[model samples]
Target: MSPLELHTRALELAAGVIGTVQPEQLVLPTPCSGWDLRRLLEHMVGQQRGFAAAARGAAPDPALFRDVPVHGDPAGAFRRSAEELTAAFTSASAGAAEPRLRLPEIRDGEPFRLRHAIGFQLLDTLVHTWDVAAALGVPAGTAAAVDRDEPLAAALLDAAGLVPAGPADRAPGRAFRERHEAADGAGPFDRALALLGRDPAWAPPAR
Candidate 1:
């Protein structure tokens, strides 16, 4: 996909997540351990800013933003951050090499190219939507989690290859199996969710 298309989808996905944050639900628990909804929102806001800075070819400006938890609707703040992220991505690489993109957040040891960055960003945004939906006692659509879209799925699978390979055999309490046991065969989202220790059949939790 073009940077423009990826940027547009990212904005939509971010907005979708932001739309899930309800005022009373700020303190709710989520899939990520040790982070209540508030902390998760704060992290997402900060992370988007961090990536925006990277997209603009700058190191994160720690001096600019405080880490103190802010009170109020997380979705509003998150949406603003999303706007910044879209602008950064579109501006940085819009007409340049979409093929050489790299986001080193997951595994910086080995450099991945453009397809990896786009795919990773899309996948990450999609999962985080589920996280927010869980916190808000809402259901994130299953469609976002499953992509039969061949281009996007192929992109994600390609980026996934860049993850450092583990041993071939599953160890005790392994996070994933070489094959998925889902009745209809695994989807790209299934592989991603499993990689992050989520059961595909489980609904996002509310706590």
Candidate 2:
């Protein structure tokens, strides 16, 4: 599938998990260190808004990357943001050939290829969906609402090749942790998550 299609699938999966979140569950810890379900959702929404802005060639603003308040309805907020993001990418895809958009959230002065940027979002969306599922006590093998998509996982693993597995991965505020080894016999999705520094075995701490 194209990066845009992959990204849309990831967003749809994320929406499924977000839709199941109860108000009381917002405080549950997620795989993202120091982030609860609420904070993770907030970050997801903020990231979508930021990327949507970038797709439209908007000026970079720090606020664009900062977490937006969920204001009680995480699912509604995420759905609206996802719609905006998908629309932005759809519109941008029709414009000038091979436009490289500035991604201030990733780097203050760097422009990334449109396809590569969408790939980045795809990677993030998949991992974040897993993060939310883990927080909700879902087992590793069942991260998505639908049946597992091995091909999608493989595609994400390939897209993850774009990430630098260097000291930069350890930088403060970096989206991923340093690359680490995946367990022996891990499947494509688990391997992909591990490559991005997420332990497929990660679970919420015992309450």
Candidate 3:
């Protein structure tokens, strides 16, 4: 699958899992510290909208990246945001001669190559899908077809390797925390998650 296809699939998988969330489940804690499932979903939708805006060359607006509150039907909100993002990316990819995107959320609104930026979004999508699934009590590997997504996992791991691993880079408020060590005999998804600062063994707290 193309990068876009992989990203779309990941987002679809996230939407499917999110669709199962009952209103009560929104209060469940996720892998992201200090955020409940509702907040995580909001963040996911916000990022999708923000990235879609960037793809359309929208001017930098902090509000664009802020968590979008989901009112009715959180699953529908997520699916719509995903579609908008994919559509914007498709248009930008085809229409632009240079294809440079202005990403305000990163590096003071630096312009990034469209293809590279898509990779970043893909990594974000893969990790957040895991986050929501984990919050819902889905086994780590069972979320998003860990085995079938090996290619995406491998690609994300490689992309993560390009990120700086210094203390400052992993400091509090950073996009990712410090990398964790993967377990022995871990598969590609687990290894990639660990490399990207998520614990493959992470589970929701017992009620």
Candidate 4:
């Protein structure tokens, strides 16, 4: 699938999960360590805007990294950010050979290829979709969402080999907790989550 298509589907899945978040559940912990449901949503909003800014060839702005406030209507705020993100990517320059993006997290002002940026966003969006669903005590995988994620996982895996293998090989400034090895008979989605440093079996602690 094209990066645009993959990214659209990932955002759709995340929106689905976000739409189901209950007011009382915002405080629940998610699969992402140290992030509660509210924090995760805030991060999602920030990421959407940040990536959208990158697609526009704008320099990274620290202001764009601020978390979205969860007051009033958090879901509405997310929907707005999602729309902006979609618009930015869809309208990107098609003629540019290797579009360059200035990602906020990089700090070094180094530009990355548009496709590469989209791939990282795609991976992050898919994983967080699961994180949101799990925090809500709902199943993250629908047959359709899994179908979309499977191909994305395969693409990421192919790219992973080019990254040096070791603890130091982790994405700059991002530390993955100990990886949970998938069981022998694990399904494609489970294996994919594992490869991305997520435990497929992760759930919120029982209250």
Provide backbone clash counts, one per model.
Answer: 2, 0, 0, 0
Model 3 error, position 102 (Å) = 2.3
> Which tens-of-lDDT digit does each residue in 1-207 have in candidate 2?
677887888888888878988999999999888899999999999999988988888776767767888978999999999999999999889886977877775656388888988888877777888888899887463443323676577668877777777686557668788778888887777777777887877867765
The collision pairs in model 3 are: none
Predict model 3's lDDT versus the native. 0.79
Q: How good is model 4 by TM-score?
A: 0.83
Q: Per-model C-alpha lDDT, please?
A: 0.58, 0.80, 0.79, 0.71
Model 2, residue 2: C-alpha shift (Å): 2.0
Model 3, TM vs. native: 0.91
- By lDDT, the best candidate is 2
91-131 per-residue lDDT for model 1 (tens digits): 76655564343344444423445445555566556666667
lDDT of 3 by residue, 1-207 (tens): 667777777776777788888888898999898899899989989999999998899876768988998875789888888999999999987863848777776666778888777877877777888888888888564543845767666666666665557788788887778888888987777777777687877888787
The full ranking of all candidates by lDDT, starting with the best, is 2, 3, 4, 1
Q: Which stretch of 10 consecutive residues in model 1 shows the poorest summed lDDT? A: 168-177
Off by over 4 Å in 4: 106-109, 140-144, 148-175, 178-180
Let me know the TM-score candidate 2 reaches against the reference structure: 0.91
> Where is model 3 more than 4 Å wrong at Cα?
96-98, 141-144
**lDDT score for residue 150 of model 3:** 71
How big is the positional error of residue 52 in model 2, measured in Å on the Cα after superposition?
Answer: 0.2
lDDT of 2 at 195: 77
Off by over 4 Å in 2: 139-147
- Report the Cα lDDT for residue 26, model 4: 89
